[model samples]
Target: MSGITRRSGLLLGGAALLSAAAGAPDRPWAEWDVAVIGAGVTGLSAARNLADHGLRVVVLEARDRIGGQLYTDHGFTSVPVELGAGLIHGAAASTWELVDWAGAETVRVRSEPRAAPGTSVDGAAPPREDESAADYLRRLGVPESDWPPVSDENEPLSRWSAAWMVERGEFDWWSAPRADFRVVGGYDRLLAPLAYGLRIDLGRRVRAVRWSGGGVELVVSGPGGTERVRARRCVATLPIRVLRAADVAFDPPLPAAHRDAIAALDATDAVKLLMEFDRPVLPADADTLAWDGDLDVWSVSRLSPTAPEVVSVWAAGEAARALLALPEDDRFDAGLRALGEAAGQAPPDPVRRTTHDWTRDPHSRGAYLYVPPGAHDAPAALAAPVGGVLFFAGEATTGENTVEGAYDSGYDATDGLLADL
Candidate 1:
């Protein structure tokens, strides 16, 4: 099958299913060929692919909106400001394909500044073999007093895999500059297409999944009330943080191997603080800045060439936790102060400011997944299907921990389900 309209696919698939169950006893709940949990990139891509194959699929999203981490806040500024996932990463990324399909305008960020020979950031010595980048920097004769207040204490160096870095087009953590890109309208423009012609039920929080029987049953709480949904196959695309937290109980509980995979992986914190200025306040020459202070990275960019000036402050790992611990208004103030200090200019505060603490979001819990030391195969293990009844797909399962990986994992899940069927 090529492309199927939402109405046509629903009508045809429903009629076929009813005909097949004509002689069976009437069931209280509605049945679906496939039930996808979470309307993120992974779930939406899987639902779209399965629907294209003539399967009746329904996506249940706990959030009120469709694009999960691909959220764009129009209220903050006249131009769309991304509160979640922002950059497209690289040209090879699958997100670029969607951008091309949508004909969205994109701007490739300037590459990172190259380090001089035999030196790291701030003229520090290069990393040694088998040494973590963080430890190597600490040992590079840099004074302890010069170090940023936020140390990389809880963050592990092994989390930064070479393959992952390469995929992101970054050759070295301290030196190699990566070329990043962003969508003109918003990252949601690329995601909105994948959700087209697919049944997505927003504000549907999945509380439990009972899959011991022939079919899978899902207990979902939504705006109306709690309801049970039955499906022959179920694809669970919940974030690793949510899964690790055991937010949704599974009947017969997952096997020891699955549980082990969930425990082995790590979900790190990341917070994006967006500040919109009434006028251009940041330096035009610098598109991005990596500070050696409280704020790890500060990126300044425009929604369009002529759009209002906006600065995004990103903090990861322990720094993220520190910022997330503060109250919402305090967090914004801290970020604004940091931006001004870094730019060496007092930022004009005539406009709006916003931020999203992914670590605090109930549905996601954390930003994304990371492969912990000695858990190289954890992603594949987590992605593996359980008794052909429960399938898993997410950024963690893909091992890429990117929007592209999440989108690709959906196709991977659909292929696996189709093979089983």
Candidate 2:
């Protein structure tokens, strides 16, 4: 297929069965059994399920790509590199189902180092009662010199409650330490199959959704011009940040409860910087190196045993914001400097550098959603359907903030829609 055309939009594999209702360009509105907004994993999952049930499903995406945050760039290195989500957090994660179906190869990542509960960073005494992780670090006499310059603005680990710290420590030691896995091919390989046999129109930015009556109407703008689509029910899988930003107007507006939930949910700021080197700077066995400096954390792994040397540096929260504020070249230089410092030598000259700042990306204003201290119920509220006309599904709605969560939320939204019908 060439691409989505204005005259006749690109259709999924089985779209021919619904052509009578969808292919009429002269019609005022393109009709469908269901219209899905956003071509991310959630939307695609919903579309696939609905299409399998004989529903005429049309998925509209604002971006040219389909994966959304599941982006994997094969051209970045000799081996595929993920610019968005890279890890399958657990064996039972729904992502693994897709991986199996796609026959994609996966490699388990080395376990992360763990700190025992009440353990001191500098071999000092145990933490005091109710001491936060940051406070514990300080009590251990861990030098402030170890942290990045933006550490002052960053939320101190010490702010975390004791219960939260204990849970994190246990999870790090038992669950997350060595259970992570990466798709040898790229996340796209696993996700792309979900769009099969569905109509997916790329570059269709939904500008407005007017659902005042028995059905919903969508005003979509694309490269060619504006078009309106109508459907009995609509599934909106837009990211939390996008919804919070009111990027797409909703007619009659969302209910106060939904609005409140949207307002309560927070999207985290994050940046991933990928650099390729002419030679290894760190030990070949080194899989991860965490810095107390501006870089925050750097995960070093060869894309493949023999692939080009690459390292992925990640920063979140305020550190990410600070990093993003610098010019691109400056950020690259900072990453190089941090890597060199960690390697205890001047790092080899990097052959290439790339980064994706989720905070600045229009489609995804932030990395993922999180609930504030008192807004634990926000995800449930956000996931609730509005009068059966609008359905919500995303990582935020699922409260999991993982690819598997997004996929499952899509199914949950579809199930809700079917039950209503």
Q: Scored by CA lDDT, what does every candidate get?
A: 0.71, 0.71
lDDT of 2 at 354: 82
Q: Cα RMSD for candidate 2?
A: 8.2
TM-score of each: 0.80, 0.80
lDDT (tens digit, per residue) of candidate 1 on 1-78: 012222222222333433543443322338999999999888888887787677788898999998788788877777
lDDT of 2 at 208: 96
Model 2 residue 3 CA deviation (Å) reads: 34
Clashing pairs in 1: none
Summarize candidate 2's per-residue lDDT along 225-308 as a digit string, tens digits: 998999999999988899989999999899998999888766777788898887777676656665667564344446566777
